[model samples]
Target: MRKIIVSAAAAALLASGSVAFAAVKHTTGTIKTFDATAMSLVLDDGSSFTLPKTFKDPGLQVGEKVRVSWEMSGKNKVAEAVKIAK
Candidate 1:
């Protein structure tokens, strides 16, 4: 019984941690804003992000549609921005 309880607790902890890691995918949208100081990027969907430390793309300016691969910290998303895929 104690082992079973321990297993359940472990499972719950795992589930909680899993929620922190966001899925990586290609999101294409125009830049709504950019904050160089904060290192944040805002997309046209009204969603925003503090640029992930993993992002490597340059030429990221406002009003450009960029294909980015990002993760989510809850509803907040941060991209490892690839490039402006023209």
Candidate 2:
């Protein structure tokens, strides 16, 4: 029984660690392009991200500065949220 408890605790710790590592990443830069039809945006630095369909549109336009929160989905960087930068 004690060994089982220890094993369960170790598994829980590892699971929590993975969740912590999956934290969202943020980037700030000018918008080079925003394609609503394609559901994607490119930054001035050439970094591009696929935006989720539920992502709120801030009426983004070319050259507008913004901050994006994203995470890796397979091999693609998928944006979870975006906001205009002050």
Candidate 3:
């Protein structure tokens, strides 16, 4: 009975921890620069993101407003998607 309670508690904690780590961050701003070669972009607000190697161009352009979905990898914010914003 005690072992069962402890196992359940551990499982609950583990589930919550996984949910916390699975969070996808988001940012919205005008693009300041874009480099297809580097697979990166900088926002006018100074935020920068590294795009995935398989990323396809979304017709991004400087001064265009955008919404970026991303996740943190080491010290970099790796972009998962970039969408043109109205």
Candidate 4:
């Protein structure tokens, strides 16, 4: 019984650690292109992100500086939020 409890605790710890590693990441750069119809954007530094279906446009445009909050989903960087930057 004690061994089983310890094993469960270890498993839980590993799960929590993975969750922490998967936390949202942020990037800032000038917008190279934004295709609202395609729900995607690329930064001048060559980073690309796919906007969520529920994402609202914040008037993104080429050459605009913006910050993107995102996370990796498979091979894609999925954007959680986008905010225009100064």
Candidate 5:
């Protein structure tokens, strides 16, 4: 009974941690610049984010609307996903 209770508590803690880690913010704006060499992008709103090397191309181009999902990595904003917004 004690082991079962401990296991349940551990599972709950792990679930909460995952939720916290998955809490990424979204930004929507026009693509001001896309530096493929640097793997980063800047929005017209003056927001800049670093992209993960594994990020797939979303057919990005300047002057196009896009939505970016990102999270804070250290002192930098790291992009998790990007999508072209109609």
Candidate 6:
């Protein structure tokens, strides 16, 4: 009985760890391009994600190298930030 309980507990921990360490949405890259109409960004990592159209005014531009962090919803991802490094 004790062995069975221990195995179940270990399985639960493994399952939770996978979810808790889900892939991070942060990446560092230069803005390859931006289209106001499209509200999309092309990063140097060869990956891209769209910014929330409702976000406050953007203070970034193409060619600026910045760190980006984002959040995911369903199959879509939204840019949570775009910051320049000192």
What local distance difference test score does each model get? 0.76, 0.94, 0.96, 0.96, 0.94, 0.76
User: For each candidate, what TM-score against the reference?
Assistant: 0.62, 0.88, 0.88, 0.92, 0.75, 0.65
Number of the top-ranking candidate, with TM-score as the measure: 4
lDDT of 5 at 54: 97
| Candidate 6 lDDT over residue span 16-75, tens digit each | 998765555787888888666787878876767787877553577788888888867667
The lowest-lDDT stretch of 10 consecutive residues in candidate 3 is 17-26
Model 5 RMSD, rounded to 1 decimal: 3.0
* lDDT computed for candidate 6: 0.76
RMSD of each: 4.0, 1.3, 1.4, 1.1, 3.0, 2.9
- For model 5, residues 1-86, the per-residue Cα lDDT tens digits are 99999999999999999889768999999999999889999999999999998988878999999999999988899999999999
**Residue pairs with backbone atoms closer than 3 Å in model 4 (clashes):** none
Q: Where does the lowest 10-residue lDDT sum fall in candidate 4?
A: 52-61
Local error of candidate 3 at residue 63 (angstroms): 0.3
> Candidates 5 and 6: which is better by TM-score?
5
In TM-score terms, candidate 6 sits at 0.65
Error of 2 at 64 (Å): 0.9
lDDT of 4 by residue, 9-69 (tens): 9999999999997999999999999999999999999999999999999888899999999
Count: clashes, candidate 6:
0
Q: Highest lDDT: give the candidate number.
A: 4
| Of candidates 6 and 5, the better by lDDT | 5
Clash pairs, model 2 backbone: none
Q: List the residue pairs that clash in candidate 5.
A: none
Alpha carbon lDDT at 18, candidate 2: 91
Encode model 1's per-residue lDDT on 1-86: one tens digit a residue: 99999999999999988775545767778899977777788889987776776555487788988776777666777666647868
lDDT of 3: 0.96
Better of 4 and 6 by TM-score: 4
Which candidate model has the greater TM-score, 1 or 5?
Answer: 5
